[model samples]
Target: MNLRNKIAAGTLVLASATLMPFLGTWEGNGQNTVYADKLARGLPTVCKGITRHTSPYPVVVGDYWSNERCEEVERLVVQKGQLQLADCLTNQQIGQNTFDALSSHGHNFGYVSTCASRAVGLINAGRIAEGCKALAWAPDGKTPVWSYVTDEQGRKHFVPGLHARRRAEARLCSQ
Candidate 1:
């Protein structure tokens, strides 16, 4: 089935497929490398941003994943993330672009956190445009929420890449 049909059917398989390139573009398909997540206080991450918490296999700092293993894990991780996000928005009637944007944002920040965000609250309140705007800003309406990455000292610094990603997500959501 096509992505639109699958989305209309309330299934996320095709949606996941459609969102894979978006995720890979942002996350980078580091299939064989396990690196420390500077944003997450040095959490070991591998294979398209799969951490120990997200991956089915162990995610040690020095570990290397085979291409097939990485592909399988990436698919599993994205599917799980989509499921979590879908469950959170079970009652909301949103479009494919909005769902894809939210899925991407949720994948990076976390589905639970995204669901509880001011953006989601606005969406639930039927203010979708405002919700899309809210995705790029904090409750104070000035700070870029997802643009900061934590350093080893636990200090947060703004990252242009993350800010750009948020902007892209907001644009997608607004569409």
Candidate 2:
């Protein structure tokens, strides 16, 4: 082989070695992942909930490790979910409650590992009994515990709304 051919061959070899771990031949044990997103171009279809996809193009000698290939994909997924949940929480659906944000924005899953939002979801789903029961097992316990400090008149106001009301009151008093 000429010098240029030898260099090209060496590069091909290096690329192949780098991509070996994610070549789609290695199977996952529900532990360390051997493949990135999908297993192969056409994974055999089976099971009730399994999904599959086909690769758009042939695997070259040196494809970069995709984000879907990392060992910490689960962690990354959780982090992404947390960010998403925060965005959802900040929206007007819950009145932008400060209690939710203070309580890790309902991502605590409590000490017993249950999402408080699930109970809330159930109530919204018209299964109040089930939702309350679910929250009873949550970290803070009590199916629908509201975060609060009593006002002068003792109305149970949502924390964020209370802050807004206080601000408005101050503005009015200043006027």
TM-score of each: 0.84, 0.21
Tell me how many clashing residue pairs each candidate has: 0, 1
lDDT, candidate 1, at 113: 92
Worst 10 residues of 2 by lDDT: 45-54
* Model 1 Cα lDDT, one tens digit per residue, 1-175: 1134445576544335557788888888665788887667888988778898888799998887898998888888877777677666643467767788888888888889998888877876778888888888877778887788867677889998899889889988888
lDDT for 23 (candidate 1):
81
Error of 2 at 171 (Å): 43
lDDT for model 1 comes to 0.78
Q: How accurate locally is residue 63 in candidate 2, as Cα lDDT from 0 to 100?
A: 38
Model 1 reaches what TM-score against the true structure?
0.84
Name the 10 consecutive residues with the lowest summed lDDT in model 1: 1-10
